[model samples]
Target: MRVRKLTFAALAIATALSLTACNDEDLTGQADPSSTSTGSSAPDDAGSDGSGGSDEEGGKGTVAGTGSNENGEIGKCRTDELEITASDATIGGDTEGTVAVEFKNGAGRDCALAAYAGVDLGTDSGMISAERAGEPVDTTILKDGKSIFFGVTYPMNDSGGSGVRVTSLVVTPPDETKSVSIEWPGEATLPVTDGGGSSVKVGPMGSAGQGEG
Candidate 1:
């Protein structure tokens, strides 16, 4: 009975040692929540520091008409900075004729222009009305020494018994109040219906060398 107790006590001591080693192993295997990684890292945000890289693409970088005058925005063409001239009239047939009016930019800097020019064809009696022949083009950037042309077409008949002779032609550039006048180029005249107003058609402004008629 004493030998049996000694063997049982030895087995109990071995079991206690094994349980202590297992507890130590479990404590070592546990991870700290703060230092452990959960998943993949997040991506970085771009251009959040107010740099100009993204602002340029979004059209918010620099304001126009700022800094140097050369770099500033371009304004409308002024009358003082332009040279106006007209071509001789060419009769299409017995009924219609066309003449081209040219505007040359004489300014030291660039400017912008668009739309049809205002024209006044006056006879000995009174002023004649005119209308735009076609739609206006997009805004044209006129650099120094550049030019644009527009055409004016009118009735050329003088044998309608009420035909009035055209003597002078007055031209005003777009967005300008001042006007320039020159003598008529040809002998074209318009028919006056029962003393009513006569009409001429003007084309939209375009680059030089283009077909104006």
Candidate 2:
């Protein structure tokens, strides 16, 4: 009878030990929620056009001029009332291959221009939109003869000597949808291709004080 009681006691202890081991295993095997990944990988063609793989992909909303629509006192500059022109800008007393685009109020009235203007380069493939460089500054008040300027920075050193020749520029004034296609001032060319490092950055709009040249 004592042997039977000892055997029963050993069986109960073995069962208790087995359950404790299973509980420990369950606690250790649980996955840490913080380390688990959530999102999928980015597409292979991401940032191919130098758009940084965001909402600016395929050149849509590349130069998001959001701050331009805030001023309602002087009214936004209309596309037809503004005369747009481009010229080779001399950066730091030397032409560092930058283009200065000028906007003048030719409609014999006063208008306002704020934030970055939408810009795109005319290439062989299609229009390559420019990315916004810096934040918007003060509103540019354009009188009949006054002008506002923005600079376009691009890679100009064509090592292969067969760069993409930029023939024209598609410009959209602040708060306007109608774009104007102006011939690229001077023979401007980029050293990169369409899908390859073909990046173009545009500064915000400002008067002559904002480094127009």
> Best TM-score goes to which candidate?
1
lDDT of 1: 0.73
What is candidate 1's lDDT per residue for 19-138, written digit by digit as tens?
999999777666443234332221122344444457775554245433445575688888878898888556445467777788888998788876767888988778875788766677
Give the top-scoring candidate (lDDT): 2
**TM-score, one value per model:** 0.60, 0.58
Indicate the worst ten consecutive residues by lDDT in candidate 1: 37-46
Error of 1 at 132 (Å): 1.1
- Where model 1 places Cα greater than 4 Å from the true spot, the runs are 1-72, 89-95, 158-162, 194-198, 207-213
